[model samples]
Target chain A: MSRTIAVVAAGAMGAAVGARLAARGARVVTSLDGRSEASIVRARAAGMIGVGDAELAGAEIFLSIVPPDKAVGLATRMAAAIAAARTRPVYVDLNAVSPATAREVGAIVAAAGATFVDGGIFGAPPQREGKGPAFHLCGPVGDCAAILAGHGLDAKVLEGGVGAASALKMAYAGITKGLTALGAGMILAATRHGVGGALLDELGASQPELLARLAKGIPDMLPKAYRWVPEMREIAATIGEDRPESAVYTAMAEFYAAVAADHAGEERETALLMRFFAGRG
Target chain B: MSRTIAVVAAGAMGAAVGARLAARGARVVTSLDGRSEASIVRARAAGMIGVGDAELAGAEIFLSIVPPDKAVGLATRMAAAIAAARTRPVYVDLNAVSPATAREVGAIVAAAGATFVDGGIFGAPPQREGKGPAFHLCGPVGDCAAILAGHGLDAKVLEGGVGAASALKMAYAGITKGLTALGAGMILAATRHGVGGALLDELGASQPELLARLAKGIPDMLPKAYRWVPEMREIAATIGEDRPESAVYTAMAEFYAAVAADHAGEERETALLMRFFAGRG
Candidate 1:
């Protein structure tokens, strides 16, 4: 039996996820309300039917796949819409947020009589050749991964509830993206010291593997720096308040914010970093 | 002609450096005023002739190689002693300190009629391997690297004066030790989330190079974590005041402080991290 699924956003991952399910005979639905033209086009291309927030109650599963900052707010709004409904679909949040945020989302959706699944998506869209993109699932509502997996999307059920998948995500991203932030910070600091080029050369000569990672990571991260600021803060909070270790990610937040502004304005630092790495490449 | 030189503290690196000089026919002197029996033993083994603070003024060069906290104070005390001398030695500040502190030391020594050199040492003690441990030199008195190089030390003269070598050291150390701190912090953060074992596996599978680096770094760092706390703080100060990047090192300072204490107490995080990486290795 084909399941009727409602995907909240039709951005790259959301649309690709919908396309995967739609190909496998599932009826995919999305709300195009207040979305950009590109998003609408993507949703349509992914074979998603446009629906209203009020109509979201008709679906079997609701997957939230928006920016980190919008994760909670969207859940709140949807919970409100579903409050008067007799039947509520399971609401799954698959955003890059902290465990604390996931629990908050859990509380909201549960209050509305909708099951909440904490999810963390790790990997590219489902179009890749080998293996499905791992959509790590957790919480009381989490076995939803099994449903998505049955539909050809790679879904994984993590053992711990609510915060587990997100905790895994936060820790993983803290290393991957956090390394990028550290590399960029070092590059900027080295540049300030006038040994920027020499440092790169020296790193290549000795720490070849690290230099290679930086070379690949910097270009991949530049355009996405704006999106990463809040993600870093989420990572910081995930590290928790009791320990000062969280400040490393907090520092990363500022680093990304500065780079984001530079990338947006095409400033000198932006031009230099991109050109330096691209040239080296 | 063989030169008369004095090493301020006969600690590990200092004793080793003095031994290298003493082995090469330099008259190596040290002050054993308030050192431990172990330090006195090491100094004697290194062939360092014991001298008073008054006698230190008689040497051609006096190298300051204590901990960062003690770097400035040692310089001040030595400045007072050397001030009464007819011919004061070059009081080169060679501690792991910030450029600002290096500059402060420079002022102190210059007021005492002694030339000040800023130096940063890289690599293990001299008796180890093929290449000599590099002593990177800067500032007016920095040309003294030549004197050390003449006696088997690998001394390199950098272009910038005073703060340049220390700045280079800070930048270099921030990347090297800073990366170690970041790695340990992430490891600890991951452990808190209950996916610690999974993370190590995932990292080994995905980021093998980084995992390899961590495997090498953590064990090497665990025992030395206490010594590194102040170094992290110095690196933080070296990142300067305006930028928030310093906080990353500040966080590292705290992280290392915790790990150091854990190592001393043989606590769980310490045991787990050391065992995990050791088992992996």
Candidate 2:
């Protein structure tokens, strides 16, 4: 059975995942009204049909893939179109937002008369990696995951209501990204003290695998740092402000913010980091 | 020719490393004047000769292997004795302290007419593991490393001035212990939000090794959480409070402090973590 699927915004993950569905004979429609030329090109290349915002509600399934900061805004933007449709689509939010934010989005979508699935995507884009990332879904998932899995996506239903998937996502990312920030912060501090080389040397001798991971992960993080700021804050929110550990994510947000600024500015700290991580200044 | 080496206040690491040195024919001396009975017993079992504080300066080499909080106070206490001795021993401060703190200790030792070597130990004690940890040294080391190396300890010299070794230690511990705190924080948060099992499931599927590390580390961290408080603070001091990342160590300190309290109190959080990590609620 061919399903009418609307993948909004046509970003990297969206376009890639949409291509998989389209290739598997699903009619993947996307709204590219305000997206960049690059995004339009990606959507077109991925065999997705472009549609107006109002037409998005006509699809049987709606997948929202956007940045953490934009997750709420996107849900609110599509609420009116979804409410006016004859049959409300199963709307899935697959952004890297906290459980709290997921619940908030779920409420907005449910109020608009759609069955909202709280979701989180793990791993890289399928098109680029040649392997699809897992799509974890919660909250009255029904046949939505099966539908997506039938179209070549690795969609799985997690046990719990709305916010379960996001909680897992927040916990997972908090460790991975938090470690990266800790590594970068300590390495930079070591460099400032003129012992960066020694730190790297000791790590190479002692924790070689961890050193290699930081080497690879830190550079890969530079471009994506701007997006990570809100995601870190989301993790902080997931942990809640009352907890002492919440401050870790807040610091990570601030650290990423600094790294983003460093990357955008003269690239002084970025170059130092690149030199340390990638052996290039 | 065997050298006389003084290893102060025999804690776990001190007694083990002292045992290794003692076994290898270096005369290991320690001051048990104010140490716990357990410490004194360990020192004696390690074959370390107990000497009065006044006689500690008479050894050819003095190794300070106390906690980070006690490093400076020990040095200050021993300064007058070192100054009054006929021939001052080469003093080594091997505690986990900030570079700033290391330099401060260096100044105090140098003022007492002893050649001050900043040092840091990596790895577990030799007696427990049957292998020695690396002893990284800086500042006019001057046969201090060679003396330890000759006695079966892996003593290596780092390049730079007084603070190099401490900087490396601070950086390394910051990453290792900091990651442990971050993992514990997120897992506890997930458990609080009723998604801990889901988080562990996802981690097992994606990051098995990291999950295993947390399972082992968070349990191991409980007993040592009290000691890590000062070490984390030293790392925060090393990073400098002006930097955004410094807050990470502060948060880690606070998190560990809370965990320590939890471990001491009703053990609610501790039991939850143990159930998640060790399957023993």
Candidate 3:
């Protein structure tokens, strides 16, 4: 008997994950009520079955994969549907968020009489050929990893109850994405001061690996700058408002917001960054 | 002919550099004015000759190697002494400061009828048996590099004028030190949340290089955190007041200030960081 799983709003990551589960003999159902045509096409191509929001609660597992800002709203929606259904599925939140936000969602799921599993995904989306991303599960995961692994997903259960996975996620992304923002900012400032070449030369002679990481990261970050805005805010929240390190994430939020605006507008700054890494990369 | 170079108020870097010059047969002079006993001992051990403030102006080259906060004060004092002297030696501002600050020092030296060279140091202090730090010089640095190289220093001339070298220094330090602060903050936050062990495990599996860097950098940064406070501020100023990236340096300044305070006060936070990297390092 193929167990049914509800993967919400077929975005890039959601659709890819849905495809992987579907390919491994699982019935993947998704609610695409307000999704775009591109999302609809992705869903169909990924072999996901589209159904109404209420029908989504009938599945054995509900995977909430959405933007950081949308995590709460999706949880609220799923709670209502799960409360009305006879068989409530386990709700798994896999969005990149702070630990505090994870606990807030956990509370909502508990109120709906559904088992909640806190999860965070590391690495890129699953591909047809390559190593798949790891799904770090926390809280009362029970047999969640076994179920996820049965569907060809890489799932690892971490110690501690809720927020462990999110904390790891926040810390990891804080370093990686935080570095990208810092590199882009300083490189632009150096270029503005006409010592950009010298800075690069110094970095090559000193920290070559860091320079190489920036070359690859800054270019890769261009298209995804918009998505990182709220995510950085989430990281700030994870670090707590009382700490000085929290301010770094807040500043990074403002930086990504500016980059997103620049990427959407004339792309002047974006072009400068692309050119900086063009020959070097 | 052996050049008489005045290296002011011999601190660690100043004393080491003075020793290198003295060993290469240059006459190294310094002022003992209000320095601590430790500084006096270091200066004497490094073969530097103690002289009065007015006598320092008689040297062929004046190297201002002090803390970032003391750069302007030293330059002002040098300008006065240069104005009263018969022969105005070339004044090199070698402190970590913003481009604007460098230009300000340049103007002050020029008004006193002394040639000014804007310079910044990269790498650690020169040792007896290892690679020496590079001295980057800008402005009208005529035979300054040749003179410094003759005394066993690695002197490189940069293009443009007064602010060029300072700009390079600011950009380089901004990245290296900025990353260290970000790592320390996030690791502490994770530890506070009880997910620190998992965070390290994940980092070891994913970003092993960054983990290695933090393990070394955090411990090394303990004692030097006090010196980095003003340097981080200079980096913030170098990025200009209007940019979002400037905020990062401001936040980093606060972070280092806190670390310095913590290190001075209770051994609580400092011990936590030390233990975090103890066996892993």
Candidate 4:
């Protein structure tokens, strides 16, 4: 009674999860008809079989891991694929979209008579093979938790339907990434005064406990800010019109984008962001 | 061989320092002919001897501890006393004024053939007897550090001239106090969304290090913010036209003033300010 898992649009995180599942003996198929060469290489390296549109019909689980802007379109495509299949598969829209967007995707999969699960990834993929990050899930899938646990992956079922998982990610990212932007802004402003060294020393002396945490946490978080920008914007949109804290993260995305554009030819955007803070740029 | 120490316009901090010196067997005298009864009472409690204008002419050390706006006028009055003195005393200006103002005071004292020292206090008076806060001194006065050390008080001599001691105090206060104001503003803004609890919990979970400090620091510092408003403004002026970080503290002063005005009841102002943040006001 083996189950076939179809991972659509396999990139870094999707490929990592699919690779782990395939290595653990699940039949994994990835559709790579229009993906980049880098993504194709990553999917093949994960030991996933390249499949055509018709081959996806036999999958028991269909995971959509496209960009936030494309989540609804991908969900519509997956819904059409289920309609064409001999047996419908459980469809999970794991992209970083708003709760409203998630509901739209949920309606698409529901119209096609397939189970819809809302999922979000909190951490990055493992560098090697066996270990991977937790996948938080919610929505109208009763046995998804047991299924995920059976595969040796951590999964948490949150409250509400379709939107709660995205809300948690949005709230968590707003503060962590917001603080990074704040520290960068303050440090740069202080340096312009020719008293940054003095200010840092004074902070250490007067508020040693706060300064200790800020110095350690801010620099460590800067390198990962570029990757988190889109996710932060998605979280902001999910929180909707009333939450201005979401706007704070959108501002952070702009800050990181500027940092990315400023240091174009060096390392990855994340690495260059860190180097700018360290005074290399 | 005993030296007379004159403390002009004795208030909370001035009286506290004078008392500490008096407790160590130094003769402490204060001019109290035109001062308010509250100040006279504080001077008596701090062990300062009330002296007439004539008696101030024989003192060996003169300390001007007046308001920032009144510093120059008080310096002029002290200059008349210095001119009448049988033997010149070492003059110290410990008001929260710009460096230019201190230098103006320096010119007055030097014209009367007296040694001048610029000084600033970095913390509140001791709650109990026989203890004092850190005091910083600058300007050309031989063994000023040794004289302060002899009084059993925490004192340091900054080498960067008259402005350095004030600059150090200003820079230190700006960050420690500025961050507290920033935290309060953000927390209040988040409360508008009716999800402050969720936001705080998320902050604690994602950024435990920063959130822990903000919770403890902001609440403790808000009550004392009223007393700091005047000094912060003086610091802002002392940093002069080039430093924009100074404006942050000036903005905090305005915020504290608004909170203070809203909490106008003499007996319940502190409690009322806390209630405002708790959303009960």
Candidate number achieving the greatest lDDT relative to the actual structure: 2
**Highest DockQ against the true fold, candidate:** 2
TM-scores for candidates 1 onward, in order: 0.85, 0.96, 0.94, 0.59
TM-score for chain B of all predictions: 0.92, 0.95, 0.95, 0.79
Against the native complex, each candidate's DockQ, computed on alpha carbons, is: 0.48, 0.83, 0.73, 0.12
Candidate 3 C-alpha lDDT tens digits along B201-261: 8788878888898988888898889888999999989988898878888988988999999
Per-residue accuracy of model 4 over A170-228 as CA lDDT, tens digit each: 54455444555445544544443333554465556556765565566566655544555
DockQ of 1: 0.48
- Cα lDDT for residue A60, model 4? 83
User: Per-residue lDDT for B1-281 in model 1, tens only?
Assistant: 77999997999889999998898899999999889998899999999989998888878998888888888899889887889887888887777788888999999889989988888876667783455567878888545888888877887777677887777677767777777777777777767887676567667766788888888888888888898899989888877757777788888789889889988996778777775675431
lDDT of 1 by residue, A111-217 (tens): 99898888888766778245556787887754477788878877777778778888888887887888777777767776676656656755665577877888888
Q: Tens digits of per-residue lDDT for model 4 on B1-281? A: 54578888777777887888777777889988888998899999988999975566567767777766677787777777777777887777777666667888889888977788887666666545544666678787577666766866676675557655555556555545555555554454434333345446545544566666666666676555566567656655655545333444455566666545544446244553255445452
Question: Pairing residues by index, what is the TM-score of model 1?
Answer: 0.85
> lDDT per prediction?
0.81, 0.89, 0.88, 0.65
For model 1 the local lDDT of residue B203 reads: 74
> What number of clashing residue pairs does each candidate have, in the order they appear?
1, 0, 0, 0
| Candidate 2 regions with alpha-carbon error over 4 angstroms | A128-131, A279-281, B128-131, B279-281
What is the lDDT ranking, best to worst? 2, 3, 1, 4
